[model samples]
Target: MGPLYCALISQIAIILAFAIIGAGLKYIDDAFDEDRFSKKKAISIAPIIVLIWICLSLFDSVSATILFSILFAVLLTGKIDNLIFKVSTIALISILFLTQMLNLLWIPLVFLTLMGVADEKGNDYVDNHATLKLVEFLFSYRFCMKMGLLSLCILTLLPWLYLLAFLAHDGAYESVRMLGKISVAHQRKKKHTIAISPTVNE
Candidate 1:
């Protein structure tokens, strides 16, 4: 294959890797939240995942780096009470600073961070409150970050490929979340059925 073809393959691989990791993380979080997974196991596994995520970010473009950092920050903020999340966030931040992956232009970083925070808050609000269908759908998938990234791409401030990668990550995250919800519901139904079933005397 030509060099161009090789490079394209590499980029696609990275995007797919990000999608897998995103899905895995979402599954872990959901399992833990539903008490299907123990805190000790999640805590033990978190650091490894954080390290892998940071290493993958290094292979990605600036846009991905900033977006991932914003995502980590949002997660930390939301789960401030969780020890594993706090440690993971601290480790990520420290590594990003040490590696200088976060030394981007301040204006865009600030703008994107604000947009990300707004999206996180809006998503939570829409989850609990009835709202317009369109607004709920947009926030459900955290479209604010996608919209921000697309605007930057249009302005030639960011690469288009990174935006596509971000979408893959978000899509995988959502898919895993939906599957987790379904699994939880199925488990509840099974338990209810067992509870109502009459036992046979041996």
Candidate 2:
């Protein structure tokens, strides 16, 4: 009964962590709306999301955790508009690959490359100054569509993998502290939001 109770609590905490991550990403999405998708901001979010996945992996199926990492790679690579962006994307991919290997790297690489190329080509729908328009369009439709699809795939696979693997085993209490970290993050965001709102209002 104690193990079951801990598992139930841990699962709820995991779900809430994901919900907070979604909220945090939605905050980024709002920022993207304001500045129209700054490449630097987008690149930075990738590692943060990956860190979240790494934390979750402690309590999730190996397959689901790996899928999360792959999706992180694909989504992060979409925002690359400069050398720094490419380098960061490559570094993250390499880390994930070296740590997790081919089973976890190949399919995401395929999706990343395909959707990235498509984004490069779909630059005609946003603005008029050719180069600027291309940048805008890449962020507007192509990145959004491709990343959205990949996120959908990750969400779809999570439950089945969890059931099959039964990751909420006895060691789950070891991971509950992750929820505290996420809560701290939320508090930080709240403080930042409060700090910035006054300036914006002024």
Candidate 3:
């Protein structure tokens, strides 16, 4: 198949994976509680998220795509309500930040922060503390994950951007659908961390 077809299939698979996981979480809310959290439950979604990452990562250069996908997976692992997974994710981010393998460390930092917010919502808890209130004050409700996906999509299209510019055409509009795939991976990973963050008390 061609790049367009490959990209299309990847987008569909990523969307389905995230939708399945989201439905599962909503359907089995109690299963996520401390008493019921198990290795089986915590790990069942790991492979699925990884698969989505792999699928969507196909849109860019192999190394960059895979690296970005790994970052997304690491972030998603934190949503399992397992300390080890969360810590590992944080550690990986820190190492990458220090190593400078991943550009724009602030991107992951902001990504993690947003994940923390979403995870708190997933636990059916809203943090209304003075600090959280301050954070909420600082950030708008425009959905950071969406913003990140938009950035990723735009970045992925850099080559196409130049091509379009050279061609002096309107292919950019045609590229919007590509965002669906990238957004699925980004949003899924973001949601997992967001659902389990600490509540800020005021």
Instruction: Give the best candidate by lDDT.
Output: 1
Off by over 4 Å in 3: 1-7, 17-39, 51-126, 130-142, 151-202
lDDT of 1: 0.72
Instruction: Give every collision pair in model 2.
Output: none
TM-score of candidate 3 versus the correct structure, residues matched by position: 0.35
How many pairs of residues in model 2 come into backbone collision? 0
What lDDT tens digits, residue by residue, belong to model 2 across residues 103-163?
A: 4434443454455455544543344344575568455444643453456357663344232
- Cα deviation of 111, candidate 3, in Å: 8.1
In Å, residue 190's CA in model 3 sits off its true spot by: 33
Instruction: List TM-score per model, in order.
Output: 0.83, 0.38, 0.35
- Candidate 2 C-alpha error for residue 130, in Å: 24
Q: Model 2 segments beyond 4 Å from truth?
A: 36-48, 62-92, 101-202
Clashes of each: 0, 0, 12
TM-score of model 1 relative to the true fold?
0.83
Instruction: Give one digit per residue, the lDDT tens place, for model 1 in 1-202.
Output: 9999999998897677667667656756765666654467666667667866777767664644555646654864474445566677678777777888754546556667777887888888998999999999988776777888789889988778877877887889889788777777898999988877765322
Worst 10 residues of 3 by lDDT: 164-173
Please list the Cα RMSD from the true structure of every candidate, rounded to 1 decimal place. Answer: 2.8, 11.5, 14.6
The deviation in Å at residue 121 for candidate 3 is 12
* 14: Cα error in model 3, Å: 3.7
